[model samples]
Target: MDPYLLSRAVSELGELLRVNSAMLVTAESCTGGLLASTLTDTPGSSDWFAGSVVAYSNSVKQNVLGVPESVLEQHGAVSEACVLAMADGVIRTLGADYSVAISGVAGPSGGSPDKPVGTVWMAWAWPGGSRARLYNFQGSRDQVKHQSVVAAINGLLGAVR
Candidate 1:
């Protein structure tokens, strides 16, 4: 929850969206709507910020954002497959030029042998291509969520170039 870093992220996202003249949409899980909230916090955000879907539940991810049921079943919410689907789904569903998606277990609990707490998967999708990344951040739940949002914004900025 570093305000300075968050400010930089918001400024960078604003600049990127302004340069591209593109709209961005988000599909979020572990970070909830933090990514969306951060974008909308900027003034004149309506110029490029499209919308967001807080698809915290698998059913919402499948039904609202159009994430594939198979993807969810096979990879769960925090996997690369699911994050990619979420990114693509939000872009298509929201008619956005760029989209970012995130899912993770940001908690003191929910850690498994394979996926531990603070395990986050993020994806960015645009017209021609898409990419996803997995991060194992170390912190409290709030801190993990904050880091995920920062990463999501930075990933979106990176996606444009």
Candidate 2:
């Protein structure tokens, strides 16, 4: 990811959340802690940034974020069901007004017939509503992660409005 674009996204998201007095939590997998790190890059992010859970493993996803084992078994980690569960779980566990969850296969490997590399599943959840989307990006591992982070942040911005 370009440092400038990342900085811009973080700045924009920070301002929006600050104005709305909203708290956010993120559950990340393929992007690891990148999204969390990006958001925290902003000064005074503590106002609207609650915390993040890097649930890169299924055990952590289940134990920390409360993602159900059944969901993961049924839908895999990169499916809409799993992402939605992850988003809702993070909101419940972290006590954030909004939460975003990302799970993806961003690599030169892990490509199946149905799900190729760069296949990402992102979900956002608030008090009363939640939504998930599937995105297939084209690029290297770094690029896929970058695109996923941008999409996750942009989704939060849209949800605030």
Candidate 3:
């Protein structure tokens, strides 16, 4: 992991937490619990970071995060709809002020023509609304996951701002 970049991300998250004075939650899939782990790694993260859910499977996404079955069937797990649902679900379930969600095909093998291995979908949800974005990072599974976590944090910072 890039310590400098991680440090910067942590600093930015801390700043956002200080300014907005709100807590955050994370719902993760392809990036697993990396986003949550990174946030919790920082000292005093509990002041602003609420908690996280690692919804890796479709069943978990639907059952745990309340992602609609229709949305999953229509858009697939890597789609914007699923990510948005993840974000919204985390915020609603955890009662956090904001939430970030990520889903992707970060793998050495799970690459379809339409959605490649590095294809990642990220979403950020606040009190009023939420939005999702797509990213195509080029790297190995670990690298892609790292990129996804970084992007998710950046999106949260932007949303809070």
Candidate 4:
């Protein structure tokens, strides 16, 4: 979650999308709009970054992103299945060439035995492919969020390339 490395990754992602003439969007839950904000921090990001959806509530995840109610019920937000659905939903909703979704519990309090604090799930979707991963980040809430955004952009670089 080093600031320099994070900025470098975001710059790289913007370059890749611009070079490919592709647009990227995001769906965020635990990270809120941090991912989108980071991308937009790039000077020319509007050319590549489409928009972001902060689907922090289950209602938004279901209504806005089209994440299935069943997925939430079965696996909860911090699960692979939920992230996959969220990624697909954002891509479809935003009509972007690529999409990244993050859902997690970045907590100092909201930890359960099953999905503890700092447990995060992320997914990236591009064209006909997608990837999902679980992360257990350490440190404060902001650190987990920064790490999530970094992992998400890195994941997009992997998929888009």
Best by lDDT: 4
Q: Summarize candidate 1's per-residue lDDT along 1-161 as a digit string, tens digits.
A: 57877787787787888888888899999988988988888888898888999999999999988888988888888899999999999988889899999999998998898999989999999879999999999989999998898888778878876
Number of the candidate with higher TM-score, 3 or 4:
4
Give me the runs in candidate 4 sitting further than 4 Å from their true place. none
Residue pairs that clash (backbone atoms under 3 angstroms), model 4: none
> Which is the better candidate, 1 or 4, if ranked by TM-score?
4
* Model with the higher lDDT, candidate 2 or 4: 4
Indicate the worst ten consecutive residues by lDDT in candidate 4: 1-10
Model 3 score (lDDT): 0.90
**Candidate 4 lDDT score at position 18:** 96
Candidate 3 structure quality by residue, lDDT tens digits, 1-161 = 47788778787787788677899999999988998989988888888998999999999999989999999999899999999999999887888999999999998889899999999999999888899999999989999999898888788878888
Summarize candidate 2's per-residue lDDT along 34-115 as a digit string, tens digits.
9998889889899999999999999999998888899889889999998998999898888989999999999989889889
* Candidate 3, residue 125: lDDT: 91
- Cα displacement (Å) at residue 142, model 3: 0.5
Error (Å) of candidate 2 at residue 118 is 0.4
- Kindly state the number of residue pairs that clash in model 2: 0
lDDT head-to-head 1 vs 4, winner: 4
Give the clashing residue pairs of candidate 2, or none: none
For candidate 4, lDDT tens digit of each residue in 15-35?
A: 999999999999999998999
Cα TM-score per model? 0.95, 0.94, 0.95, 0.97
Q: Which portions of model 2 miss their true places by more than 4 Å?
A: none
